[model samples]
Target: MPERSSGRRPAALVIGGGMTGMLAAAVLSDHADVTVVESDVLPRLPAPRKGLPQARHAHLLWSGGVRALENLLPGITDRLVTRGARRVPIMSGMVSKAPSGQWFRRFDDARHLNLVCSRDLLDSTIRTEVLRLPRVTLRERTELIALEGDADRVTGVRVRGSVGDGVLSAALVIDATGRASRAPVWLTDLGLPPVEERVVDAGVGYASRFYRAPASTGEDFPIVNVQADPRRPPGRGGIILPVEEGRWLVTLSGTRGGRPSRDNGEFVPFARSLAHPVIGDLLAGAEPISDVVTTHSTANKRRYFEKSPRWPAGFAVLGDAVAGYNPVYGHGLTAAAQSVLALKRVLAGHALDSPETARHIQRRAARPVGQAWDLAVGQDVLYPGATDETPGRLERVAAGFIDRAVDAGARNPHALRVLLDVMSMERPPARLLAPDMLFRVFLGRKEPLLDGPPLTEAERKAAGL
Candidate 1:
């Protein structure tokens, strides 16, 4: 953390006060005076707001992301857990149906875990903590109207507030504005060529609702997941994750024509219609607490800003502004957290006012984006009418290996360990190609695949199944 100067501190303008923006502020505050401008008036407590419609859905911080976030904000995980968020262990505390139509057994050994809670709580917790930093200022109900500088160097941002519009000059400007980011138009306005942008929309739609859990399904309840089989036309999936307040956040999803609806009547049927009927069965006995809320913008979109031949000195983009994944993958927050770490590392030794520094940060931040993008679009592109462009030779080969790996995971603990590693973002996809993992995938002795959901007798009784 290199302070810009002791006499006059360098300033930064961060657009969007969501999770990504908050993390960016936390990291930037270590190097400069940071200001976060948000269009919506943020709630003081852990409650939902107008800007984040997706907050209605469930959100989790995988172990890898939790580690990255912990590095940036110490005691953040304990803070979340103390506030009622559950740290659910992977595999051991999960009952999941793989796309290969095999129910993965709940192994006794757990390696990875994730924090499960409402997006509201996750955002609010980070917001409260990040804004308290000495040099961080939060501006509410402010709209970013335009970029302050030209194509070669970004000096600040022109924002419109309730009183009037004004330009806030800064040495660095971050666009953490999320999916609604207009960075492309903003850059083009500054005379820079548009960056390469790609969208791999599975045409996936999300339908989520909250439910009060059965009394017997106490604090230690397992997460129930029914994954969509991409091999099947119009893929569908659902999950039952226990969040704070002893309730479950159930989100059902479908691809293209098979999307789930907000109609209360169709909720359970969609869950029942998944590869496994377990989610629907569990929901049948649970009490509903919220109406079904639906969102259709679950596309995997990415802007390759780093590839641009010319990048401005004072401008950088992070989080959903750079790349956004399907919520079902649960990698958006994790990727953003990792991006913040990348930014912090880049700023450690580089001058804040250097264009090369901004370029380095942009390129490094996109590393996690590439990882999550490949993982998400690899499956999303397989959905019917997902995209017009076909997957390249490498993609097809990777997909082949993934299918075999999934089949291996269902029956083999060694294979399952590798799968969980990649799924939890602890390891890269190349880990599956390691010699030992390849040996297990090809020659390891396999246990019999499960014919149905692998729930214990006590677990079934608790859910009143």
Candidate 2:
């Protein structure tokens, strides 16, 4: 980490104190004085706030994101687990219905594992860690009105406070305001044109609710997922996640006209209609704790800020603000963590005051955005009424390869490990195209696909199934 000269602390101003913003603040705090300006008063515990409606749904911190979080805040995972977040081994702790069919046996190689918890708990834990940094300060109830610089350089930001307009100058300004960000307008105000944009809207809607688990099964229950078959007529999926507080956060999602309903009465029926009814059956005996909460903004949207000819100095955008992917893919937080890591790497080697540093960071951060964009858009484009343009030949080939690899993963442990690595964000998708992986895919599923969830007799009795 670099230090400021003249005994003055270098400052970085962050807009939106959500997970991405807080993670960025933590990374920046090592070398700079940081202040996070948030519009809503953040909660001290694992409670939802007005700003994050998506928190009502189930959120899985993929292994890659978990590693990044641990790197940013050591001992944080232990804290979360201590508080009841479940560490689910990739195939061992998951009962999944894949596009190919039901996944077969779990391999002993379990390096890839996802962290299952509510978005509220995940964000609150990270926020608490970030706020504990002495160099970091948080300004709740403060909103950013506009940028305070020209197209060539960004020196600071103008914020709206109870008193009036206030200016906070800093070497860097990070925008993490999420899917509804106004970074385009802010840049245009600085005499720059709108950044090139891309959208693959599947029009997916989500309906989620929390339920207290059956006492016999308790908090250690495995994650149950019934994924939508995109090749099917209507795209629908359901997930039962064992989150913090010994509860299951179940979400049912559908695309376009097949969207789930907010009617609490229809929730169970919708889950029951999924390709697999395990999630529905499990929910039958549990106690509902929250009403059905629904959201419809599950499109994959990206801004090509890094491609701009003249990116300003001392400014960068991250998280959903840069590229908001479909929540059904569960790539948002992992992408944000990867972006923060890129920022840390860029800042460590370059002078923050340098005019080219922000551009460099933005360019590096775009790598993850591009990868996630490709992954989300590839699947989303298959849905009805998803987009106007068809996938290009190369994209079609890529999707074909992925589909085959997923089919191979249904039985081959080696192929399954490779696929799970990519899905967990620990490895790039290119890993699946490696010679060894390609051989497995060529050979196809090594064993017969399981007829149902691989539950032991004891587990079945415990769930009263």
Per-model lDDT:
0.89, 0.85
10 residues in a row with least lDDT, candidate 1: 1-10
User: In model 1, which regions exceed 4 Å deviation?
Assistant: 1-7
All candidates: TM-score: 0.97, 0.97
Flag regions of model 2 displaced more than 4 Å: 1-7
- What is the per-residue lDDT of model 1 for residues 1-465, given as tens digits with 9 covering 90 to 100? 553444566899899999999999998898789999999999999887889999998678887898888999999989999998888887788888887687887777757878888898889899999988999999998999999888889999998998688999999999999999999999999999988999988888899999999989899889998888887868899999899998999999998789999999999988999887889999988999999999998899999999999999999999999998999988999899999999989989787776688898999999988888988998888776677877678877878889889888888888888987888788999999999899989999888878888888888999999
Worst 10-residue lDDT window, candidate 2:
1-10
Please name the candidate that would achieve the greatest lDDT relative to the true structure.
1
State residue 66's C-alpha deviation in candidate 2, in Å. Answer: 1.0
